[model samples]
Target: MDRSNAFVLVGAVGAGKSSLFNVLFDKEEAALKTQAVVFETGGMDTPGEFFSHPRLYNALIQTVSDVGTIVYVHDGTDRTCRLPPGMLRVYGGKRVVGAITKIDMPECDPDFAERLLRENGVNDAIFRVSSRVRETVGPLKRFLFGELSDGPHACGDVERKKA
Candidate 1:
């Protein structure tokens, strides 16, 4: 696996990050299952157990700095889908591909999620997704790896990928 070209998942708890991770990487149990929290999907050969915590920003930073792209997951169902303050502080101007997970849920609001990103200064690309369904994960992956493929410093590389 190339650590230089990996994808990092970030979001609040119960945001379906793990579920999206599993769907994207084609893993059934990429993250530990719980009543509330869900992990993000990935191509990691060794899938680990999921643990909830408030320090996800640190994890996002470590993962983003090491990997090529960051998949910042958010719970679209939640009215407050804004990026965490710590995350914004660390990955503020970076190339983060936003993903609104749990689109199948009743409360997932695409407009609110987009508004949250704008309010938080996240001007980069964003994607709405439902990890429970396979098809929704494809666009997010393509956006992160296809259009946002260039290095963070490269210009004209932040355009959203076309489906």
Candidate 2:
């Protein structure tokens, strides 16, 4: 389990999964391919189709073999979460982080995304960051690297699950 890139991310298409991944790690730029799985020294990025199709979920479940954390992304501009309830818990025992991408969009409401994620059993912290802006992603980076002190974030910092 390499901590450097031990995070694996999942989200529907257009949720900015690749943008966030690129910003988080200074990796070589590449054109985004449809339904392609991107693996790095530290993390893995899956295609949106994986989640939409139940059959592909096995691949995501199997991916847990290498990652220490799982992050589910939400597009703040989207009208709905799209994920089935309790989807975050599917990767049990792995730390899960929820992120709302495109938060800076004019009509984007990160709060709504956070609520949707929470209702879906994302007991840990839910973050709001605009992948388009590098600065907005720093908080998420800190949380991902376990750099923040543990506490309930009124503004969404890292938190422990309630039993």
Clashes of each: 9, 3
- How does residue 89 of candidate 1 score in lDDT? 52
CA lDDT, every prediction? 0.57, 0.71
- Candidate 2 regions exceeding 4 Å error are 1-5, 27-31, 152-163
CA lDDT, candidate 1, residue 62: 53
Q: Which residue pairs show collisions in model 1?
A: 17-39, 17-40, 18-39, 18-40, 19-39, 20-41, 21-40, 21-41, 22-41
Question: Against the true structure, what is each candidate's TM-score?
Answer: 0.67, 0.81
Stretches > 4 Å off in candidate 1: 30-60, 89-93, 147-163
Q: Candidate 1 clash total? A: 9
Q: How close is candidate 2 to the true structure, as a TM-score?
A: 0.81
TM-score of decoy 1:
0.67
Which candidate achieves the best TM-score against the true structure? 2
